[model samples]
Target: MSKRLIVVFFLLLLLQPYPFVWSAEQVSALSKQPIKTVVTDRFETGVVLTKKVLLPNGDLYWMKRLEFTSDHREPYTFSIPLSGSNGTFRYVERLPAGNRWATIPVDTKLPQPSGFLQTNQMSMLLNASNFYIKNVQGTFEQQPNPLPINVIRTLDGYKIHVHFPQKKNSIAEIWGLESKESLVDWSSTPDLEAIWLAIDLQEHSKWSWDGYYVRSPQTYTPYSPNMFWRLPANYAAHSFIITGGSRAADDLGWVMLDTILPNQNREGYWETLPRSEWLWKDYGIGAGFFDTRFNTDIATLLLKGYRRYGDRHFYQAAEKYSYYLLAHIDHHHYTNYGESEGWLPADYSWKQPHKKTHVSLNHHLHEMNFLYEMYLETKQEFYKEMADKLLYGVKNTKSMWIKPNHDLHYAYLPNGKMGLQDYPFLTYNDLVESQSLFVKIYGRMDPDLAELMANKKQWMDQTGVKGYRFFPL
Candidate 1:
């Protein structure tokens, strides 16, 4: 193949579902009978798993240990082998209702599988010939349960349908899954992993409410119909957009941008391409809508997209945001509740009187990093200078927020105190990455920043970013 043709072929191949096909026997072995965690009416549950592990640098192993359950007793005895133990399987969230993100132990007896899989994901081994993924959350309430799959109700002594959790990242997990319930058995998996892949790498040509267009306003979120609930802004907020640098992510972002840009209010601070857009219906819930941090992140990604796609608007968006940050380089009123500091706003948003809140270590550092990237891309010294000034805020305030064990308090509270809680050790990862970015920018790292990074990493090594869902670290 010629180079150009080879490149095309490579992308086409990449678009295919995870290339592991199970044999007739492989399918039969798992489906004919259930591979379960229950024993004589008791359960031997494992930890709930996610597509990505919070801890860095380790491999994800598959589990016979389906740990998400109410029962806390020891194994009554499991249906599958539980060997090669590494971690302990501790509970991250202990809420009575049990609505939380759970964690895996430092070491456990988990079997390494043929390819990537999560304890939460259905192995394609389950016979789901009936139901379909109705919406983003894989809700199946409206669909008919003709397959007798998940049809067992109260009279049947069933409390909740027992099945594996299926939160696939790529649509790759369900390529050949078109079986019927009669020939197959059931429909339990949500099987909704199309959030990243643009329906097999094909473009939507135009955005529509009917199709997947990179999540936003999900029917009940803010700026969505009525703010019925905030719909998890922390992880879901910038993640889709932050997934922007690569060609595939850019493809998804185009659809997402189309959804957002068309209806945005765009009447906030930063007035530059970097300015915040006011998309709320109430008119004035949050002024400026946090253009400083959120828009800065968006602008940097836009810069990346512009460079690769060579679009003028991309450059314009980032250009405005970068200038906004620079224009307010001396935001004295917005700093540490009193003293003049160059930190970016993380917890709250406003620009007129400059709404101030506790300084978020992650937000400040992230903005600093974004500024440095903007400098590198546009060859501007001012962005770097601003980033340098922002770095000083972290160093001076480190002792105030960082615990002696190196775990970070989530933010510098407005009451002139450090928060009691930490982010399960996420700040450590931020500190480590920030040092690398600065090192690349200045050809060396700051001594104070370097020391902080070292201590944070040591802390991470000792405890793999363990955090609870309801309560923070």
Candidate 2:
């Protein structure tokens, strides 16, 4: 035969389902008998076949143990009032509750299966999925149940009814179903595909609401809808526009360029706003806070915009933000910094005047890393010079947060003090953040320092010191 003819012959054979036919008399005989039950009970019990032994190394251990086994089964089906096309009675939901976005209630009732079947077969095929009998003769069987049984294929799975010659209201279970439910092919249904597309389009359309871009409607608060602007909402917006192709890029990017960035300060720093409609303030509840965390994030966003659009304005904006943060380094009035020595205040400005004197090792590492990023971006000697000074200040100052063994002091007060009582114990978070920067900075600037940081990272990983723990040596 030709290769094409041979291929067609095999394809036809593959499409055919296995034939398991029986005579009318045989069917009637099987129908009268109960489909044997298949039960799969799962428990945490394990067999300790051997006794515990004490080792020479002062360790107690079990010799041999047998773990529990599990069998996937068709869960028990409760007879509910199913809707029927022929019958007048039907099922309906009296109450509907839940978010439409998460779940939608189907008000229309579905018609019940036309027929039911009881089976004695080891395995049964229904709706292209398989159902297998898990137990036979009161013992769980690894193989499927034997043939000569009645079975009905339904939307959920094959429903097997039980029958006893002399007993009524008898229950027989068939567990360990190979297939439990029908899998819907959404792409095969044009209407469902269209609905899915509409939902996706609608979701993307609502990315930006009111004036600023938002992650979700759940994050939306009338008083401060733009609060996430300080967080990662702006970055998410920029990323959405950049990665989401022409439609998102044209609409959202245009709004960002024309409306959003222009409304902010000339130095390119966004002020904290108490209300969505309120004007930006310099020194009140939400004002004049140059945080390294916030500025660095915004600057990175602007830098991404510059790289994508080849817009000089974005670069200038990013540079201006870095400069603004750099200017507030000492912040002499509120911060307790001498002429030659100073720590990077966590927050500096009108709102957190008192906290300006409170130095944090974590925040200090963040600022230093931000400065280094700025240096890399602009290649400005001034930024590199500031980075050098920060490196020196963190290491040499009276509030040296890192120790010789690479253990980190959580935070430092203005009095150059840090430990568990006043500050916090070293955490995995603190170690990773500070050590990451240290490795990065030292790798580029000083190899010796980098080696030390590498050792610290190794020690931390090996020791398994996590949570709020003493500085792991």
Q: Which 10-residue span in candidate 1 carries the lowest summed lDDT? A: 170-179
lDDT of 1 by residue, 225-295 (tens): 21111111122224445543322233334333322332222431232211223323322323224444455
Give me candidate 2's TM-score against the actual structure.
0.40
> lDDT of each prediction vs. the true structure?
0.39, 0.38
Report the error of model 2 at residue 82, Å: 37
lDDT of 2 by residue, 1-473 (tens): 12453344344335533112344664554333212222234333311133232222222222121222332233222122212122121112223662122222212322221111112222111111111122221111121222222334455434433211211121222211111121112335455323322322111222221124222222222222211232222543555444533222333343354334553565446554322122123223233334455555566666666554544555666666665666566452222334444344544343344333455555565566666766566454565565555655555543354555555555555455664321233333433444455455455334333443454455566666444422222
Give the TM-scores of the predictions, in the order they appear: 0.45, 0.40
397: Cα error in model 2, Å = 4.7
